[model samples]
Target: QGVKVSGKTVTIGAATTHYDVSTDEKLRKACPALAHMASLIGDPAVRHRGTIGGSIANNDPAADYPAALLALGATIITNKREIAADKFFKGLFETALKEGEIITAVSFTAPAKAAYQKFRNPASRYAIVGVFVTKGKDGVRAAVTGAGEDGVFRSKEIEAALAKNFDAAALGGLKVPAKGLMSDIHASADYRANLIAVMAKRAVAAANA
Candidate 1:
């Protein structure tokens, strides 16, 4: 998912306070997860108003962009330097952005195959448990969002399973441990852990289909 700020079209510079990357035809084709996740952000208004840069920069625990960025191995470009997605996210509502540095755009190389599945909070449309899976030249990557207490994180277990065989059946009987997951009024940590496995399976299935 790449973020470029412009008035009405995609560009490298900033003029408009916000730009909708979700509707970009090229982006939709390159990374379906970007379009899918963006469409699921709140409702129509939020989708149109929220910028991709704004969402990733905020790094909300339940935010969708972070998971996509991590799964796709995107690069976060700033005024000062570029940061890898794995290193960009620091913690809950935190990032590696330095003072006076602004995120100009993000560059993501679309995976050979990828899909995202989310169990969302009905009212807010935010993911209570979201999983993004990608299988490409680098390998298989499984990233979970809205479930980590620290924020989005990669699931090694799911990734390992997918690496062996990129199919939903390969993940059968495998589970992500509940440790370090978020437990709140919405869903418990253990429940989120379960959702991670289920969502990952669905994501793999979708990618294969």
Candidate 2:
């Protein structure tokens, strides 16, 4: 599902990312990983019909939506009520959406600085540690996807560091806890935890650039 702001339109599709028309760069800037993943969502035919809303509502852990949505502090407009991005995503492939509540639209406030850094597995291209950073009205937010087995989560360590210094040097001494990080064939929990710091630093560097 995808919603158009100016025309107040919402559409659903089986494919992902919705590439038939050009996406707003400002929106892309709000969530860079989504912008990057849009190209890989599917082939030309699929790109023509895929929708970001559908993927987000679906909440695929490996998908790119959760990180961007959370980092950008997007608002999920549903039939029942509006939910903040932080509260919208509940777990792997789950959301706050009720049985009959459908997403009407999603709106994100543009950020002054933002970037997405991902360490993709070679075969699947899924992020091992996807970090999305944003400096917005609410301050800095760091969202991590693919590192947590439970689902996407905010990286408070990185956020606190960035909030204090807003630079790569700020992240130099911070350590991301490995407690709940994901581990599998491609990487161990320690590796993913390390990648979180590396990606966060990269994201900060990119944002500053």
Candidate 3:
């Protein structure tokens, strides 16, 4: 029904639906950015029907969950074993999941401050470029989705800047260069690179707010 956050970690069952994640009071308190991201996915109807695990297992390059999970340093538990988020995602619509292995749940250590910012594609409502940022025991981690040619990826430059100063101003001069980023009909690699920086700045602002 709802997600589970035990100790410093949060877990969402594979069957747990998106609407539940978006509305679960405990989950909201534990990780507001995750809940807020759930709320922003598609519309009410879509949110009602989508499952977090489904989105995660699909590993869509533009999907929201991958960015958040990666940035949060989450673990994906499956029928076989547990996989770290960093190792879970392989590429666009690809994952470390084997032929029969099923994702049971995803767990993450809740960050002290975290936020997600997305530039949506008008019709699809999918992220043209999305950024997820977190500051916690692991320090600051920044993950970018929808722009990477290889799927979701961590931005070391952004993380380094935010790790030093967790403020939007710290990232003002920094840039996510347009290399190895995807170029699609909706957005060019250069445009997505720019979006990455802007979204990172906005995400930092949102985390502070």
Best by TM-score: 3
- Superposed by TM-score, candidate 1 places the C-alpha of residue 199 at a distance from the truth, in angstroms, of 0.6
List, residue by residue over 101-177, the lDDT tens digit for candidate 3.
Answer: 99888888899999999999988789999999999986999999999999999999899898889999999898778
Worst 10 residues of 3 by lDDT: 1-10
Best of the two (2, 3) by TM-score: 3
Residues 39-151 of candidate 2 have per-residue lDDT tens digits of 65445665676576687788877666688779988887777788888999999999998898887667676577887888887766667778889887679999998889888
Best by lDDT: 3
TM-score of each: 0.91, 0.84, 0.98
Sort by TM-score, top down from the best: 3, 1, 2
**Residues 76-136 of candidate 1: C-alpha lDDT, one tens digit per residue:** 8888998999999999999999889898877767788899999999999899999999987
Clashes of 2: 4
- Model 2: per-residue Cα lDDT at residue 182: 80
Clashes of 1: 0
> Candidate 2 — which residues are off by over 4 angstroms?
1-37, 40-46
Whole-structure CA lDDT of model 2: 0.75
